[model samples]
Target: MDKEKLAYFKEKLLKMRSELIDKLQKKYAEAIDIGKGDGLDSADEAYKIYNRNLMLGRVETDALKLRLVEDALKRIENGTYGICISCEEEIEEKRLEYVPFARYCTECKTELEKKGLIRM
Candidate 1:
């Protein structure tokens, strides 16, 4: 990848991480506020369920994003940011534009799916 493009992706990834963290923090604050009130039984139960689900969702999404950010940083360090992991080939520019964190080329990704390494 070109230096400018790599820099752009780096900035984007950092921003995404920051935004995710901010969202999670806000969610935690909301959860705290919800927990502090001894509201109606049904409302309390619903709040608990909602908070659990929200925490789980945020955890999963943030974990994936963190992995992507780490992988991108590794690629930047190893000088292979735009290269596919499975094929050891250059990844499609268009695909990278759509998913800057992709570690495998389309073919390898398809193969991994066939092998049950991935479901999609």
Candidate 2:
């Protein structure tokens, strides 16, 4: 990729990582008191547990995305951005536009998904 494109993707990845970190911080704050209160009926307890689990799951997903964004930044620094890690081919611009932190092209991503490898 050209310097312009690489710069664009690096900027995008950095912005995304910042936003995700902010969101994750808020989520972690919200999850701090998960199922904390006592004197709750069965229904209330169940609801709290469910909400806690849901929030934790969302945070987990965000954390994973954050890691991907960080890795993409590393790739940019190593002069490997825009190249699919799996196939070593130039990833489609459209796909990169959609997912700036993608490590694989659409074909490889699809194959990985089919093999139950690419979670989220």
Candidate 3:
């Protein structure tokens, strides 16, 4: 890809990373507050548990996204941003458009899925 295209994808990934971080931070703070609340009612307990679980899931997803964005940025640095991680092949532009952080081409991604290793 040309430098302009690479920079475009980098911009998209950075925007996504920033949004994910903001959401994760906000949810994490809310979860902490819920944990500190003193109510012991059943509804309160359920809400706390739900919030905790949701926050945990969000944290994990956010961590993965952070890694993906970092990897993508590293790719930009190394001049390999739109290549498949498994096959070292060029990823489809359409796929990249849909998923700016994609690190695998369709074939490799399908193979990973067949191996029960789907990323998402």
- State candidate 2's TM-score: 0.94
| 41-113: candidate 2 lDDT, tens digit per residue | 9999899989999999999999999999999999999998889989999999999999999899999999999
Candidate 1's error at 80, in angstroms? 1.5
- Each model's lDDT: 0.77, 0.92, 0.86
TM-score of each model, in listed order: 0.76, 0.94, 0.89
Superior by lDDT: candidate 2 or candidate 3: 2
- For residues 1-120, write the lDDT of model 3, one tens digit per residue: 998999899899889889888887887787687677575898888888888888778888887888888888889899889999888989999999998889899889888989999865
Clashes of 1: 0
Clashes of 2: 0
TM-score ranking, high to low: 2, 3, 1
Model 1 steric clash pairs: none
Spell out the clash pairs found in candidate 3.
none
Candidate 1 — which residues are off by over 4 angstroms?
A: 31-39, 42-47
lDDT of 1 at 51: 80
Residue 97 error, candidate 1, Å? 1.1
Ranking by lDDT: 2, 3, 1
